[model samples]
Target: MTLELRCGDVVTGCEGVVSGNTEEEVLTAAAAHAAEAHDLTTIDPATERALVAAIHPV
Candidate 1:
């Protein structure tokens, strides 16, 4: 089962999507991309919750 998450879905005015075999893998890559691309060093609890909630099976 693959999991997908789109940055555009969680963040406003952004267009990015990521997918992986597992949720943890997707979140790790998404976090790194968020830091490098969006300059988000740390994800707060609320944002993390939102990210997780935005994840979908693909």
Candidate 2:
């Protein structure tokens, strides 16, 4: 039960992807990558929801 999320699908002008065995793991890694690579310090509630919604089984 792998899960994946693509930043390009949710964010414009970005091409990042994260995957994990669980949604929480993927989201955690994605957030860290976003902070370091995309300069995002925090993900707003709506954006978090959107990210979750964008997650797909892979």
Candidate 3:
């Protein structure tokens, strides 16, 4: 199963969606997206928790 995460779930107004074979992959992609598109250079504990919670099997 693939793991997917909707960027909108964590960042309001973002419609990006990222998926991967593993949670780590998706998180890495999401981090890149965050940095490139959202200007988020760091994932704090709360944001990291939210990102993990938002990820689901697709």
Worst 10 residues of 2 by lDDT: 7-16
TM-score of each: 0.92, 0.91, 0.95
Candidate 2, residues 8-43, lDDT tens digits: the string is 877887888999999999999889978988899899
Q: Between candidates 1 and 2, name the one with more favorable lDDT.
A: 1
Per-residue lDDT tens digits for candidate 1, residues 1-58, read 9999999998887888889988899899889989988999899999999999999998
Query: Which 10-residue window of candidate 3 scores lowest in summed lDDT?
Result: 36-45
User: By summed lDDT, which 10 consecutive residues of candidate 1 come out lowest?
Assistant: 10-19
lDDT for model 2, please. 0.90
- Candidate 1 accuracy as lDDT: 0.91
Between 1 and 3, whose TM-score is larger? 3
| Candidate 1 residue-wise lDDT at 31 | 97
Task: Please identify model 2 stretches exceeding 4 Å from their true place.
Answer: none
Over the stretch 1-58, how does candidate 3's per-residue lDDT look in tens digits?
Answer: 9999999998999999999999999999999999999899999989999999999998
Ranking by TM-score: 3, 1, 2
Each model's lDDT: 0.91, 0.90, 0.95
Regarding TM-score, does 2 or 3 come out ahead?
3
Best by TM-score: 3
